[model samples]
Structures are given as C-alpha cells and as structure tokens.
Target: MKTNRSMIRTALAACGFGVVAMTGAHAADTISVVTFGGAYEAAAKKAWFEPFTAKTGDQFATESYDGGLAKLQAMEQAKNPTWDLIDLETNDAINACDEGLLEKFDKKTLGNTSDFLPGSISECAVAAMVWSTVYAYDTSKLKTAPTTIGDFFDLKKYPGKRGMRKSPKVAMEWALIADGVAPQDVYKTLATPAGVDRAFRKLDTIKPNIVWWEAGAQAPQLLADGAVVMTQAYNGRIDDAVHKDKKPFKVVWDAQVYDYEWWGVPAGAKHGDAARKFIVASTTPQAYADLSKYIAYAPPRKDAIPQIDKARLNDLPTAPANFKRPLQIDAAFWADNADAINKRFQNWLAQ
Candidate 1:
C-alpha cells in the first residue's frame, strides 16, 4: 500500500495535481477568534463558526474580550498575535486599522460593495451585524412607559438607579441627546468644548444614581435583579433576556445609538488564509440572515434584510419604528477623538 501511494503521488505530480493532493493530505487548520462574549458569542458559534467549520473542515478556538485596542496593540508590540480574527466595534476597528494592528482586507472579497450597508466595509474590517445601544426598563416595574430619550434622564419622574456602560462612547452621546441635541447634531455638538461640558453636566444629574456595568451580560442581569429600573445595553442582550429567559424587559428605541460590529483579522495571524475564507463564508446574504434567528442584531448587508424572518424584524434596530430618531454612531469622530474624550471621561469618573 505504501508503494502504491508513492506511485500515485508521482503520477499525480506528472499530471499537475501534486499540489492538490498534498493540500488534501494535511489536517484542517484551527482558526482562533476573539469576540465580545455572552449571547453574541453563542449566536456567532451557531450561525457563523459552526457552519463554517462543517463546510471547510476547519476547527475554531474562541476567546472573549470586552472591546478595546489595548490587547491588540500589546500583541503587535510583542510581535505575537494568537488571534486569527477579532470581533470589533466600529471605533476599535477604525483604530486598529489605523495603527496597522489588523490585516488589510480587500473589499472585493465580500462581493458587490453596494449589497452591504454604506460604511459597513472598511480597509481592514468587514461588518458582521448592526446593533444598537439602547436603554431598557422592566415592564413590570414601570406602569407608565418611558417614551423619549429625555425620559431616561428624568429621574424625578422615573426615580431609580440607571445602568450605564463604563465607556464614554454611548454614554456621552446619550447625555447630549437627552439634553435635547438632535440626532443628526450629536457628533457635531459633542465636538465643541461647551458641548462636552454640557454632556458631562447632564450626566452629573444621574451620576450618583448610575450603576456602572462593564459587560454586555451585566446590563440584562442588572434589570433582572432589580438593581436598576432602566439600563443602557446592547439591544440584543435585552432581547435575549426577554425571549430566552422570559424576563419582562422593554427596550426603548428612542435615541438608540446604532453601530456596526466588524470582523477584523489580526496583522500577524497564523491562519490568515482560513480566517479570510471564514469571513467570506460567514457574511453571505443567507448567512447574515440566518444570524437573526439566533440574535436580534440586524444584518449589515442590505440584501440580507429580505431574507430575515418576518417575525424577528421588529426586534432589530433597523426596523422602521425603532430606527426613527436613531443616532448612528459616528465611527470616524470616535476614531479621532477617543483618546482625549476617554481621558476626560476617566477623570470625571474618578471625581
């Protein structure tokens, strides 16, 4: 049998099929991925990674992270990146690409650019889904439902502790919106010194009553435990709590800040080829549509919208009703201003 295999290899070599034969002889590669954990990770495993593994015979090693560029920068500085692909929020993705921490991706690899939502594809990343950061309250606790962004800050009327993420991004924007900044003027207003001061001042109103949460899972848990009457959270997390756990949470779409979650390849990935292939496979119109079955995040691809289950449409941030008065996150503004803004945010938190 050994002699027959050798003869077969030689014959294949002469016929120009040697590379194909040798490629088939190797075991599949394992792609290492890092993502924001909790329901998002579980949804990706079922909708993206698992199916990709089955199709390509490649395995995946997964890890979770809270969003930031610090870890990716550390890996690059050490000349050692263990992650093949990373799930990045828009601002982080922009920063990573600018710092050369992520591999440059060809937009052509994902097919027609027009099929996706505008600004979804970047030089180093491809958007996976559209998600929103919105405040949710327990329906059982609040008899009169809060209807506006201003209501989130009206503690006198809806007296209770508020749940907010520890970061400055969404919180700052929400502050301005609740202070009466129009949805389109959020970034413009935040760009000024007085605007920044105004936002922090509005935040001061609830500073003592704010329960800071750092993780996506914690937001829903905060509401469930009655630790907060209303909390700022990723829309999908609240959706999962409601549908999966039967929690009585109601998401307020007013002034909801929406952003894209992207798939980015680390600059020094060991399985770069496989990682790119997985991105292509996982972002197909059908694949994007299928993800909605697992989580409420809307697909970034315009074509995928039609494929989504009609029943799940209203739960997505892109739904017509929910999208009204929505504030699309200004990724470019955040990319340029994160460092300075974060410093101020940290100092304010300490005080």
Candidate 2:
C-alpha cells in the first residue's frame, strides 16, 4: 500500500479516463449497480437509489455485506464481479485501490465533486459519507464527561472497560494521541518508532480493559449490553442505537477523528460509465442531504450539510466547531503506510 508519487502517476497513466461501453443497449438500456443493504442502506435506497432507478428507468440491486472488503477481494479473485459499484470504509477503499481491484474513477462525469472536502475524493474512490470515532459514553454511569483522548486513556479517573475500532488507522492514532502526541501531531508521531512504541505501551496499560469490536453496529450494541461503558463509535450508529435500545449513550464530539465511507467501482467492471453516473446521482446535494439525515454520516459536499437540520447538523463530525479540534484523515497517507503500520499494530494487539 505504499503509493509513492511515481507509482501513483504510473497507475493513473495506465487507467486513462477508463470508461467502457454499456453492456447491451445503446443510450436507452437500464443500468445496474449494487450497494449495502442496511437500515441506512434502505434509507439510501428510498431517498436516492430507487429514485435514480425510477428517473432513469435503470434497475439496481442493493446487497448487504458484514465484511465488504473480504467479499470484494473474493469477488475480484473469482473473476465474477457481481457488483458494479460498492461502498467501503476509508481504510478498505485504500486497501482495494492499492491492489488495483477498483476501477479508476470517472472524473469527467462528476460535475461538482470538488464541492466535496479536499482529498475526500480519490482517483479510484469517492467518499460517500464522513463520520467520526468519538468518545460515546453512558452519561447516566459517569458523573463528569471525558473530553479528550488523554482523558479517555486515564481509566483510573474514568474507569471502565473501553472498546475501540479493531482497525489500524484511528485506533492507533488514538493510542498515540493519548500517549502525549497532540491531536494535530498524531500521524507525524506515528511515522516514527519511539512515537509508535509509546502508543502501544499506553495501549498495553488498558489492553485487558479492551473489548475489541469489528462491526460498525457492534460498538453501540456492546455499550447497551454493558460490555463497555464507553467506546469509540460512529456518531450516527451510536445515536440511533441508544435511541432505539433505550441506552444512555451520549456523544461529545470533542477531538474526534473523522473517517469516511467511500464508493468505488471494481477494476475491470463491465458497467463503469453507468456506475460513475450512479455515483454522481447518489452523491449530489439533494441525495446526500437526505441520506445524511438518516445515516447520521455527514456529507463531504459542503452544500449538503446546510440542507440538514441545523440542530442535528451541529452534532455531525463535519460541524464547523467540531472541525476546529478534528483531524481530517489523509487516506493516501494511510493507503501508503497501511501495510507496515497495520502489521506493527497487529503485533501490538497480539501482545
């Protein structure tokens, strides 16, 4: 995953506006695409997917995946890419692109993607929604709230079994941030040995308190079951979960790490142009605004945020105040550093 500039340029040159003809008919055929089938997925379908289909007379099938990357890899290897387009977590998108498993994006078809936050849109992928890894706690259990990564690590003062994303990216940054690197310097700190070692050491102190969660939905479920009093979770999932399950989970979006879920077409896809059109359709201001309200992930499209509820809008990771303390993830940075960093992260986790 070490994407050097020369390598990136070479890859881009190799892809050259990669567009392909439609499968059957000319200019009148119904296009096909796939997406995750979740509650939020269903929201996306109702708000945009089905509407796109109806408007264009194209049919789409939304599929659910508990493990999207593994499934995408298997599909790619099998040479049976059933999905034309699929959604991915930030790290997963990077992982797939580095392997050349996703097609280079159709930038010409995208009208105002620059309206998205800088760097959120990539050559092989485009972020569909942005969310946070915030300190979500049961307000009823704690007297005072923890405000920063340092406070979260001080289990003695804010003692509880804590849960975090089992993924390498944010979890490691959080560990480093808690170990004394400032929020702004977290990645710079991880780019070195001593900084990374200090992070693992800090993590070791609470390793026993860790309840590792792999699913986006599992974080809040664990909190509700009292498996952990506090956990780093997706703001939308936690908010919906606590409200639905009658739990006291309240999220304070201070010093949160923002991550995005992306849309990428598989490499050698049969329906590339149609997929790109679908991506443009789905990520538009109108569609993204409606989807954000339901999914709770903020749209990277600047105009999309204003269209959402002003009150709930402030709770999002993209909120102006939240952005002051927040760190915008560098996907390319992670795309390049993933292999080494993840291996070291795994080694630490194994210990």
Candidate 3:
C-alpha cells in the first residue's frame, strides 16, 4: 500500500502544533517507549529520551523487543496498547500503518518537510535513523580480508562456519547479490518463482555450516567468540563491538542493505500526547545529530547531517565511501510478500 504523503502534509498543516497545546495538561505523563534493546537503546536514552525529560520534566518507561507486528496487533485487538512510542523497522511501519495499529502523525510538528530524507515520513511514522545490514569478520582471525558480498559465501578460499540471522529478509537479498544479481535488480528478480528458488539454492550451498542468531547482539558475539569467521549483522553492532568492546571486527560494506528505523505511536497509546511531543523534540536536527555520538547510525534528516561531527561521518551508512554499492531494502515488496517468503524460509530451515 502506498503512503499518502500529500494527505499527511495537508492534514498536519491544518492541525499544526495545536494538538500539543490541547494535550498540555498531559505533558508530564510518563511515556512508555519500546525499541530493539542493547547499544541502540543506550544511545537513544542519552541522545533522545533523557534530553527531552530534562527539558520538559516528562519521564519515560522503556522496554525492548525483537521486532514484529504480532505484539502490536494483539495490543490493538485487546484495545489496550501499553507502548506510547516504538522504534519500527521500515517494513513494520508500513504494515502497521496500513493495518491501523499506529496513530497518524502530524508532519507539521517536525517543520520543513524538505529537510527530511525521502521516504522518511509516513502517515503513522517518522524516520529516526538510517541503519544497514552488513557482514563483518574478526580481522585478527582472517589473514586476508573479504571485501564483497560474494566473498561471504566462498568456503574454499575463506573456510569457516558462517553466522546468519534466523530470518529470510536480508539473507535472501544477500544470497541473490552474491549469486551475481545486480544490486538494483534484486527485488525485481526475487519477485519471480525462479528467482526465489535461485536464492534458496545459493543459500543451500552453505546451509550446513550456518550458525543462526536471532538478535542483534548475538552477531558480534558470534564473531568475538570465534563461533563463526564472519557474520551478517547490523552495522552499528559491529561498530559498537570494535569501538566500545574493543573487538577486532571489520565491517564489509559491499552490497549492504540499508533502511530506515522509524518512530511510530501505537493507536491506543496511554500517553499519546506526551509521546507526540517527545518525537518532535527528539527529532530536531541537533537531537538527531547528537545520537551518532553514542552509535554509528545516521540521522534521517538532511539538516541533521551538518550538525554531526565530521570525524564520525565515515562510519555512517550514508557516507560516500561506504555507500557505493548499497541496496535499499524494499519495504513495499516485503509488506506484500513477507508471509509467503517467511513460510518458505521456515520450511527450508526445518529440512
């Protein structure tokens, strides 16, 4: 389903920040926020939530989850959503908005639509950061570094167990790219029956050697513990490992699949007004830029780029040298086909 950008802009303009004024009495209510916890949640607390609390005297109750629509769907069906704001992946944001599980946001609250990245704004969500799925290996373990997506699958030359997430999304896309499908043509090819089979066939080559991980924190740990020579992981997780934990991991940016992480309010949020204000405060250009101080992800606002430290720019997914062969995740394609693809993935895993 297409996002109605024009409708969002028009509705937001008419409403303005009047909603903030109307909800002033509820300003100090504690907002419950959820995210994929770990280094990301820590970074957000310093850059977004704490600052908002200090400025507004509002507070936050935080929780973490491995992302999906099931919990949100259950909450909406029960008419008692506990989360005020959520950190959503692009595909989840699209599906949740379409299903009316999220509250419609007013873009006018953010000011200047053109300052944000394209596809950053949706009817029910606002883009929070730009992150990527990348592969990394322990630099000390490998005598020679692997530079491309294809290298991740070459067992003869770089022999070791492989680490992969226990999901099909990025794994399928990476398989197609390694099999020589051009980055731009991945979704187009994956849309066909033969293309899906081709991806699985490629995956079958290394299936026996795969050590599957289900969480963001596990990917880097797999590499650190020498469980796998290389693993597919979130770029920030690898960066955190190398910088924070002093692990010897090196990220391979080739054929990286980049996408946005969004802020979405659940439809029946207990602190909806407070949540809306927090979104606006935390997404200001300065706040967005400040997040990179604690994590490697890039902010979604174009204006935020200038405020970021120049030294940190090279590590971001949007940086020129790192982004050369990037493939943007196809949220619409996943929104349309995730169920069918996931079912096939599960069966493939069992067999």
lDDT of each: 0.92, 0.74, 0.91
In TM-score terms, candidate 3 sits at 0.92
Give per-residue lDDT, candidate 3, residue 22. 35
**Regions more than 4 Å wrong, model 2:** 1-39, 57-60, 64-71, 242-246, 270-273
Clashing residue pairs, backbone N/CA/C < 3 A, model 2: none
Q: Estimate each model's TM-score.
A: 0.93, 0.82, 0.92
State in Å the error of residue 124, model 3.
0.4
Which rank order by lDDT, best down to worst?
A: 1, 3, 2
Better of 1 and 2 by lDDT: 1
Tens digit of per-residue lDDT, candidate 2, span 278-350: 7888888878888866666788788787789887776677778767777767666776787787788788778
161-262: candidate 1 lDDT, tens digit per residue = 999999999899999988988889989999999999999999999999999999899999999999999999999999999889999999999999999999
- Of the two candidates 1 and 3, the one with more favorable TM-score, higher being better, is 1
Best by TM-score: 1
